[model samples]
Target: MAGDRALLRQALSTGEETDGRVEFKERLSREVHLSEARFESLAAQLRHRVLSGDGEATYVVGVTDEGHVAGIKPDAFSESMDVLNLIADEAGAHLDAVETWGTKDGIVGVATVKDGGTLEIATDHLIVGTAGHVDHGKSTLVGSLVTGRPDDGEGGMRSYLDVKPHEIERGLSADLSYGVYGFDDAGPVRVDKPDRKSDRATVVESADRVVSFVDTVGHEPWLSTTIRGLLGQKLDYGLLTVAADDGPTETTREHLGVLLATDLPTIVAITKTDLVSAAETDAVQRDVERLLRQAGRSPLSIARHGTDAALDEIGDGVVPIVRTSAITMDGLSTLDTLFEQLPKTAAAGGEFRMYIDRTYRITGVGPVASGTIESGTVAAGDSLLVGPVQEGTFEEAEVRSIEMHYHRVDRAEAGRIVGIALKGIEETDLERGMALVPKSADPTPTRRFKAEVMVLNHPTRIHTGYEPVVHLETVSEAARFEPLDGQLLPGDSGETEIEFKFNPYLIEPGQQFVFREGQSKGVGTVTQCIE
Candidate 1:
């Protein structure tokens, strides 16, 4: 039964039998027994056996000589594909080495299941985040850091496609909103002011790094995207902005929901400080401390505020807050000083990684993928394996072009939002969960994942093997999360070692995902993959 060439060849080489035709000859006996019915059954059995991990090594030597016939019904191509699909699955889950060959003589198959290799280590932080409630002055703080001003003019209405403040305010149709600034490794310590006092913006560049200070939508509905953007890259320190005058609100609380989840270090910026009196500033500081305590942070916890007392309180890991009137140009230096003190990103480019947080096709160019460089360096023509695992399958992809910002370049370093033109990948293949990786890493496609999730809203119950939309980077997909542990209730922080039925894509560990309710509709990240 095992020596059956027809069945063995079909499953191994082409993954399907040749349309009800089983040709064979008996060399030694001079009489061939062609059992077509037997061949059909044998072929199915052979495919099942190979997928079931039965034989160590099998080969179809040749046909015997005498031709014979036995009647048997054949299956459709789709049905045969199902069998091959099973084989591909088994190969991914277990087998390390396998090959199949078909020749005029017959078919041949070879397989050796060996131990898998370790994934590539990331040299830089994969993702970072910034959060403050709606109108919490998140945009103002980002503007102050990048443009050296407090008022970005239109506030949250800045345009993503156009970098100019005026153009952005005019509602320019662009995919992203953020100003890109490149700096040298030496650092930009000096802070200047923008000409338009109304805009209150200044930009200074130094060396080795580029900061595109992004002012994203801080509203609750956009919170998922805000978190998604922050989760897409590893950060130096997460900056949380709060207006001294507005204090804490419900929206601010929602911002805190995402902040407290990750282990990343954070800075608290008290904007609109000049709007209130000195005593009121101190009181606002106190209120911030109280809010921090309520959110599980200690009041005595050192947060960056603009004052010697606040700085002293922060000690080495200080939370120095600066009081800045984007109008008066005061405290701009303090902001610069804070940025200078920011910890550099972990190492530099090591492993090749980029999470596509945003992507679009330029008017002339075809398809482009954009996201912060998670790790390693990417140059033009360098092959990048990009895709995500959804519903327990790995969808493969490749990048055609890689660029920094809008400029056409051969390659880009980690820690920047790169726009890449993917070759051979259509718009369908590119999604938010997808991550670019080096060719060395053996990609694993899985649908089940074990993770630790802190429920943001109440009534939190993610059912076992329940399918939800997983949002990571710029990719989103319908994925099922099967809990290895029991049900997780709201505010109940526990570990669920569940199987992730991800879409057919490859996702690495340490990537952040937000879960939503439906296909390409929800948000979430996979915290762990248990195999």
Candidate 2:
């Protein structure tokens, strides 16, 4: 059933305690004939409900205030929605979306109303990326958080996130995986069916705020994949997991450096607390605090000062540390609270730009490009350019549809990971690192650029003609580096010229990139682009 009538009725019911955010109406057409004073009162009530819901509210059509689902005719439902929209307008809100279901008697639907200015102000969405050493409970912790289920203490919860058959067989993640959970006014929306995209999308649609987890590979050999997950997306925060028993390792340090190098505010979760003694937990906490300070970050223990203080200073160089146990469910509630209140860091203003991280094709939908919207907004039917194809050319395309976490949406703003069905190009033409922009922007691709590089590690001096693989915004290509200030040694910083060995990309100034060759690794920021 697309929309089960029974489920819809239960979800829309206020139960014993009346919900101020949810209203019910058999039909709104009859309300328009009310006297001016009565209409004014109704409008005032709707406005109050929207404000109480933090700029949004839900209305159940074809239902009564007493919680009875007395469905209405299709024609009446259409007129009711129109009247509801006018009433919402009177309350300074607008109809955002609606979902309907068919019943024996008539139809029932839910209308999502939002304040007119909310789209321009702030959105209730956030993204967090997981990074840590292998078998450090990164996936287990995320699985438990998103699914609201405890691990069996032997990698049971991990199965919820490690979707690939090979990954489950190896008991390790070999590539990037994603999980999502959200918070409504009541609390966290526990997604039992974590494997289903539809279930995840339901959580996104029903919640007041949502958090998406980009689970990255943690093994030493897959360091490149971890780096890509951390730097490629528009993540608002980082969740670095450390098993309490094992504490931090060399790989943990590497992952932490990448998290901090990208200036992502991080939350350190010391997992498996149930397996360690109280004294041992204290020791690990001290070690974590020392490492964070060594990396120039202030560590705030959420267990002591609480999530309120941590959430207030999030993204301001302060890292929150929480002791957690997937098996025992320790510190999970605090984590949920912090995520529920964390403000969105990425603003939705500026020119639209998205780096295609993946692509797909549907039998009847044509080509689809999926990636995080780095900035600006995109709507269905908008004309955009997709590429930097082999020749660095962007081809014209129209956005046939846009989806976020499998939920179809008319528009998507910055900080959202979306899959867009595009017209006017073949699926084979799209590749990772291609940029999608407005056709009028006249975007140009570049093969060479100037950047300020900081050598984090190197066996020897980096001289001109040094070729290393550069990872920049989903594009990993071999690039030749020439230090403008002569040869550079480890721990040194200098302006360098870089040229890609293969195809050009839509590189821009101020973009960050990481380059590495075996044991050597360096980070840089693009200062100038030469087409």
Candidate 3:
């Protein structure tokens, strides 16, 4: 009975959270009236409560367009069976009984319950809030939320789990860190403690329903790190935090520009808001908004509170404004609510592949590929296909174990950064853009691919078939571009028939990629292998 409700809500919701209060108002009707009598009946029978937590209960309601109640909506039909199974299996016969009826002009379905049940459901709503800017207190905000104290340590802050060759060359040091956190309507979701002051990393717990945050370093050299933070994962939304008192600096503007260009559902956090009074905060907020508008966004929502109010606003779909002060512990709670407010993490369960961001061989460990698990899971002892080395060679490797944060785990899924130990593979066999996947399902490999390339940051416009360095699957190599059509100007998209002078095999078709000029880079995806 309990499991039934969890499945119902999980299936129907487009990755959002309820206030935990099961109040039903007819969507088609204008007046916000609660059907207390029906709700009580559903609530009394314990049919609606799927998974109940401490101070949290998620309810599922099926209704029609005409302000009536139906047992379950038509679209929710197939999944409701799972809910019924759960109801029968976990809650017993009495609790398993579900009531279906028609009301007014439409039909409504209700599941009500009051009880204790532990059901692990995958998240429909997941978001990543990147903490950028050097020593900009990115880790401090993480510490305050996780440890309930200000973060004062430094070094070994892992910002991204990537599989790009350059990213691998950037290397993982004490300074590279990945932090994930989960939050809900009330407050911070429980997170494991960071290993040490310097190794501050957080993992958004699996049980988390709505929001997950990824904190990154704000140092200058980590621009690629920042790009990895953004491009490494397909995010539903982004939270860009800038210190209010410091004003808009150059790096701040550059990062801000990139985020805006991505058109990601974005929210801006003006940190240190507590340092300024109401008036000062307002002034800074205006300045930030102006800068953002200059970047082509309408004024975004700004929050200046020590409470979770900002987070609530974020959860409620307010954009552009969030204020937090780790120093005063103000607005710390808002971070979660703000995170919850964004759109849900897209269902990314298709291909189980990742670009290798970093690779190294410990004297005894063999070859280790450290990167975020982009789409699928990698398990211990699973044969991994490592491929498309710049030299066009493919190699088979074995996954010894997977690590999330610093803790070893048997497997890792999409949305988490993980490290895998590869046996029978050498460091030279891998590059930053190389990909790793399960051995059974092979990847199509080709050195030359037909793709659509856009020239961004190039010294001049790129004509069709021009030569450029191709960055794909963690490796970057020189390739000849045979444009499918005309010249590609900056910011314009064009299809090209590209053929490498020498074919580098091991990459598949349909893989998205980036092209790097001496210092500038543009984005593209593999369409067809030229052969």
Candidate 4:
């Protein structure tokens, strides 16, 4: 993807002429003086350009039609983009992204436009979360897959994903990391330099469809962080990694249980196959299959029945297993094919809802909140409420701008991770687990709820007033539980009333939650919301 972008940039630098899919413009025309007929003509041309690119097109601003890079000033470039946006709106398209570069003459930039309805396709966008035990090669596999590079047999590829300096120094990931790759008409467009943020942005802009991986910690001490990554994000699929040498460990079972609890369709990858012989790999595979059966999952090896059968029945209690080795690049292509063809199961058709996972403040952009659009759609200028603050109240906020994968967009739909610039709010007022909902929702914060919980593990029976940390979406808080049926024991299913200890949260009925304290764990679904 980086190579493709460089080629386009070089062509523009050398004064490439305008074409159907690529247009060059020295400046934009003022719309105030244009007649209706002229405006209609311009709109028609813009529509043609978008259609020529199969729902996407590029416009090179500050360039001449006759192949001249006559760069314009920054102020002039901004105005030109304003006009271009108007043109796109008139043509029923939107400016999806923009990038600029400074030249000796002036400033030049590229604008990507796409038809409004094309982004709703499920296969075009997908999110997969990675989970497994420590040193199981989770990060290494993801790094190799996204960068198309093999490891140096000593964790060379994992460096691309380790975000914090401590993690790099410790040779393990201690926090959640993100990596992405995309698919074009030709196939997957992997990152040449996975460590470069710019290269990732380029891949997001150029690919026809994208797949985002949420890499979570695999160590036992950071299990809470791993749980947050799984249950908080609106994930479409799960990629569970297991080392061929270690087979299935206690941590592997724990992570797998969380993935299954969230009802996310999952695929298992047996890593480090090169270090073990075929018999050892086979033994590990059998152990994984036996573990899956113990958890009520049907295991289907992709090597035997192929990807078609696994893809067809993955979400229906069937888990696909693929053998891979980062050093040898074995089974990477199969993994790519599976991801490319996997159908999205998360639906985004309800009223607008987004759970805040993190917050940021940019120099000129003011306060920004980011999260996955849990349901429905949100656009710039829409009125929404953002809160459940420490005071347990909701505050009004307006969407100033929307961005996905560093690309500025007019709107975002469900199942997408986006950053939304906000108006009428301070960054300090927002917190994780707070929600952004439509003004019409008139949401109420909840302090207590009733849930049907199944105890997965506990040394003893749970009684009233037992406190455990409950994880729901992006929010994690300690809650006291009282069993509705006298008492609950391990492997028991019963009703319970739970109340948050401190702050209230925007919790909805039918939402799943995980409660854990030390070695004890339980899964539950909210049955009713008590205001």
Candidate 5:
């Protein structure tokens, strides 16, 4: 990642030759080179590179003799990797990881051959998404927690995450905004003006353990945005807020259903407890318990049983309830402790994938794609395919740089939200609902897929010709749903074929989706795909 790059490089040096730790091979011969001296010679060079790197080396396949990136055939590249694998093994090393992307007519990849053995990168940070009714103090509670400052009860602290002018005037968040703080070896590390990009970046870099809040809107009209937060982002847990004075609203229950439907571990936070008497707070807790039980989930009291038990039971169909007051900062530390100790349930593995949630152009950096890495790791200089344009195709692009929050970083792993500055694409081409994937992934966009769908709520029944907008990852589009059988009523699970009414998207089997139309809502899983 340092200095110049050749697909992958721990550090490339100045001049025609590299730092001796990086190697470029168009293709490695699979002939009897292993038993011959040719293998020993190549293995000896790899060993020297490892020694030079202190037991780490980088190998770039499909490079031309002209020093250009002319990708090789897939078979040749595989053989090259096989040969490199043998060399690494002979040199007392292993191919720890490989990152692949599309080239002009073929594909290129970087193999991180290492001798130190694989180390597990723990997801020290937990991303908690907030959901509730408007004016339940979702934003204000997050603002106070991130700044370590108690709200003045006049809703002054809401500015920490709420950005839009209209949202400020209306005292409600209208879209998704993120605020993060961290815990270090000492304790919690709070920052000022966390709404700013730079401050949030500082938190991610400085803290040993970090917690991010995806503050979502609670208004009925902005329900799509809330669903986007719950469905699009790689969220670890859900925080549903219910004011003690007004326990749970219709919107609160709807949000809870969607959160639990996504199978995200949820925690109910009784907010504004100071506004009501102790008895009233107790009544709100009971109401929350009833709602959880109605939803077929158990409730655990953090105050009664403690944070350790809440963490243990929250994943096992248990919804932990915590009481909080932005006015007094009550119960903030309990949530903080729980967050600090919570292991990131999300992980980074498999093929590198990211969905573009936001896009922007830097003053001189051109277009950048921002989103959380959904599956695998990505590095600067990695080639990726982005899009499923109206034509249902993808365009090749190269990652020029990577940045987390606002601080420029060399690489990013899964579950880490980042903005990737790109080359070979215009800013106008990037949009939400699009995705970034490795070229070798060979992902295809599909218009029709058979899914196992269940109607959560509906007026009558779902028959052929029923249309609902399906929210798959970041791709949201209306699709025609035809029951494979006769018809489906509420709570009826059946096979259905869905054809995108508009643009085709990069979707596959086993992916989950949430669809909604008017008063009808449901959750489904793609069982099979058809182009």
Candidate 6:
């Protein structure tokens, strides 16, 4: 079943005409002897392949020149990737994706590469979501880390997120905020004027790799809001914070459950370490490790092990722990390195679909819809549909223009968050939970769905007539729960029918959701959508 039994050379030749965008290599290595001209020729061939595929190319590794499914050793496969990556760079491209499979001989891999030179530079952009209890320094840490500005022992640095007057006065983040910073050839590019839209856009434009932060709410009452940020956006990682002075709390565990439940790789940042003694910090770190362990995660101390270990092990059940302080700026560089080295892992394949997380009206630009591309890509002049706003119907719309980080771009791909100016919809018509999709998708909004769910935490048993707000993608609305078994208890897994008490949404089977009300909380996967 390795590489799904790749076709033989003869079989491949029986197909349609070759476009030269696909290549096969038994193995490759820098150690191989080749003259400068020969190497340049090879690189040129790779470049041509990338250009032919319109900024993407495919390479099947561990296959012979004749296309036989001959696998190679694991080490050989890695060396081949290294050489291929090098060649791609030389060809002004990058090895964007590499998937492998085990075989009798050894291993087989398929690499999907990127075209380095492009107006839409999203190949290396990463979206990070932050979650923690209030006063845990989530926003403050982000502000300091991106702007390279230390806090003034108050909420001064938090202003980078454009905190609201009430938020500033209360010294608590009540909604999702964002911060942008990135790295280039030389080093990290700090955003000095994050409050200014143009300055943020400039940073995104200049950086070779960009890291966008989606800072979520942490107060207990705003758990739903926090879940929206973590699950709504196509995030690459979750930065769960724990203040050194306070260590872990109930809300921290709640947030962590949501983060891990969504299968998002996480990094624990122990903030405000400067205010605590080393002994205190150690104790807090132990608490965090224990908490992570209880959540079935291996806590990795980046301070002890290193960056390589974190990058290589994080997705494989290991969660890195970093001690950070907004004031002292400790452990910030480690985060920067981790972020820089971390690969973009969001899903990039499928029909274009973006959930509307925010909508705003610009004085001159008219209506702008903003959200991360969940799948596929969108470009200016593309005809799309925005929907479920009226009687489960989708309205036709046109993407007049697109903006990323305040910078104008012709198009944006999956995993990149941007604002798109629409031609056929009013700003008031757009709702946070609505979606933009290719007209061909013909999406349907649902008022009810059947799901397999677990009571993550609940004070009592749940039966019919239980009303809770369901958070699926960007759709958050109160829904009534009906248990097929008549009743369900805390920690119990069961089948339930949930119907949106209000407006319908574009709900499809296999979509994960979280619901909460009062002190009850749970997560589930939709098995069927009933409109």
- The best candidate by TM-score is 4
- Model 3 Cα lDDT, one tens digit per residue, 1-531: 123344444424422234232433222111211144533343333333334233323334454333234543332432342333333234432121223334344334443333433222234436464645654455556556555554333312222232235643543222344444555555555444554312322233343453445555466665655655565555566767777667667667656655655555666767776656877777777877888767667654543343344344432333457677776767766555555454555455866787777777533234678765667666666887887654555678877545554444446667655668676777777767677877887677665567765565666677755676664544546677666656777777888876655555555566666665554556676777755
RMSD of each: 19.4, 9.7, 18.2, 6.6, 10.1, 18.0
TM-score per model over all chains: 0.61, 0.77, 0.60, 0.79, 0.77, 0.76
lDDT of 4 by residue, 1-531 (tens): 112357347547655334457777787766541457776887788888888779977888777887577888755765576677767878888777666766787767777788762223223678899999999999999999998888999998898899889998887898778888988889998998777765776777778888989899999999988988898889999999999989999999999999998788999999999999999999999999999999899999999999899878898789999999999999899999998888887887999999988898753244789888899999977999988876887899988678776666668899888889887888999888899999888788999999999999999999999999999998899999999987899999999999999989999889999999999999999999997
> Backbone collision count in every prediction?
81, 0, 66, 0, 0, 0
User: In terms of TM-score, how similar is model 3 to the real structure?
Assistant: 0.60
Q: lDDT by residue for model 1 over 317-431, one digit each (tens)?
A: 3344455555455665554554444545444547887776765653212467777777778765566666653344344455544544333344566665567866555665566
Tens digits of per-residue lDDT, candidate 5, 1-531, equal: 111244343322311244466777766877855767899998888878777677777777676544456777655665576577667767777665556656675656667677742222224868899999988989888998899999988888887677889888888888888888898889998888886665775677678887878899998998888988888889889999999999988899889988988888988899999999999999989989999999999999998999899978887789999999999999999888888877787766889999888898753244889878899889767999998865878999988667766555557788877789887888898889898999777888889999998899999999899999898887778999999997999999999999999887877788888999988999999999986
Tell me the lDDT of model 4 at 112. 77
Question: Which pairs of residues collide in model 4?
Answer: none
* lDDT of candidate 6 over 97-191, digit per residue (tens): 45677779987777767787323554688999999998898988999989887888886788778468898778778888888999998999998
User: Which structure among the candidates has the greatest lDDT?
Assistant: 4
lDDT of each: 0.48, 0.84, 0.54, 0.85, 0.81, 0.84
10 residues in a row with least lDDT, candidate 1: 25-34
The positional error of residue 511 in candidate 3, measured at the CA in angstroms, is 5.3
Considering TM-score, which of the candidate structures 2 and 4 is the better prediction for this target? 4
